[model samples]
Target: MRLSLNKDSYEDVNLYFQDEARFGMMNHLGSYLTASGVKPIVTYQHVFKTTYLYGSYSPINGDSFVWEINGVDNKIFEAYLGAFSNYKPKEYKIVVIDNAGFHSTKHIKVPKNIYLLRIPPYNPELNPCEQVWQYIKNRFKNQRFKTMQDLKKWLHEMINEMKAETIKSITGNHHYVNSFITTFKI
Candidate 1:
């Protein structure tokens, strides 16, 4: 659903696109620079342990909120919504999200100040948040982590060091996002 906001209502409206990504001990392998005719061997692990990162990004102002969650479920999603609701209590948040089962409103309590707008099923490209995940995963390619904690620490550091300008450069250039920002002057 789309948010119907009057011009005056724009002052308190904050638009965000949200998504989650999985990080694990399993590594993503990619090509590395090597001498001519030489194949580079990359170390990898097969451990299945993983964690989920739920993130929301505001394309207009490069604001964001994130939680490193252990699992994906209605309860966990509800908690994330609650935390997001509390993050900016003064503004009304319109979050664009996917049609994940855990995101079903029937099973979770949506905060009063937050509204969820589900993108069409099978159309992940419409959400700019997908770009953020791609940008993060690209950095993970060809890297190995000895433990889950180490992986999580590295991921945390990467995100923490990310500047708002970097996030905007990655996710704010989409036409869909720009249109919304322009329409509401957000």
Candidate 2:
């Protein structure tokens, strides 16, 4: 399902929530989920390292992208793939992603259970995630930190600080709105 991440929405961040009969979903970061830190200690370089540009500037329709951030790109990639591997039904519907590099990258071990489809190139509107980044980026705008520990700390703190309704406003699935236009029952 397509979603938005406008500053008015979820920021430039993607949270992967999975489900089944139980809706028993585990949330993972789609765009970036840098789960690296110095445990309880903090450092400046760590924070600076994590503060790289996080946007789709010069967003070419087919620009190659990588899940960069430290050395955890592959780890994050497998984590999401694992979602399909572990929980995706043996027979399920299509899964859509942007034409970003990471999603388009070919793998020798593509799973057969679910199809990986990409949103047409240059079509960010088809993916709700564009707005998610805006919301997340806005949350940290005009903010500065000295270390990665601080960046991580503030992110965790700000996330908790976000109002529940606010989150729903951004990522909540409102299929009913579209269904209203269509005659089909969802």
Candidate 3:
């Protein structure tokens, strides 16, 4: 599962955490790296720099995340790689992936031994990214941010304070998923 900033309402009451907040900051923040695949787009708020998926407003961002990558910092990935660094992955020749436009970067520099792949398009069943976003949206619950800055601050703090738990939630293995998912429906 992935984390996505979405607008929510509690009963008839308007909510503070709006999807627009994340997008607003992203739109204003603009892109950082280029010629890449699945680059982590981060926003620096004073002390912390939390990186999410590449911002995709108009294919402008890129692909989103799946599982723990949603709520995780890049460190998690680094750590995961570090853990498996000693082990060799399966040998493969040609890699195949879905055509997300974002995933179709020939200029991205990757390790020759490693292969990148994507699933088919219009196939949510194959992609966990959609599930991740749905899960993240549910985290807001009845809470509303006072402002976009507030929500951003909350998210930043959330990541910092609850790194492990956040990782679990993002990976779609947390009890919070039920709460996160039901927020929109009810």
Number of the top-ranking candidate, with TM-score as the measure: 1
Candidate 2, run of 10 with poorest lDDT: 18-27
Ranking by lDDT: 1, 2, 3
C-alpha displacement of 131 in model 1, angstroms?
Answer: 0.8
Across 47-111, the per-residue lDDT of candidate 2 in tens digits comes to 21542212121111111111222332334454545554444234232344565454544553444
Which candidate comes out best when scored by lDDT? Answer: 1
lDDT of 2: 0.39
Q: How many backbone clashes does candidate 2 have?
A: 18
- Give each model's whole-structure lDDT: 0.85, 0.39, 0.34
lDDT of 1 at 12: 79
Residue-level lDDT of model 1, residues 41-60, one tens digit each, is 87877989999999998877
Candidate 2: segments with Cα more than 4 A from true spot: 1-48, 51-75, 83-94, 108-115, 160-164, 172-186
Error of 1 at 33 (Å): 1.4
Candidate 1 lDDT score at position 57: 88
168 Cα displacement, candidate 2 (Å): 3.7
Q: What are the clashing pairs of model 3?
A: 1-67, 1-132, 2-132, 55-61, 56-61, 67-170, 97-118, 98-118, 138-180
The superposed Cα distance between candidate 3 and the true structure at residue 99, in angstroms, equals 3.3
Across 40-111, the per-residue lDDT of candidate 3 in tens digits comes to 545433323233432111011122221122333334433333332223333211122335543434544443
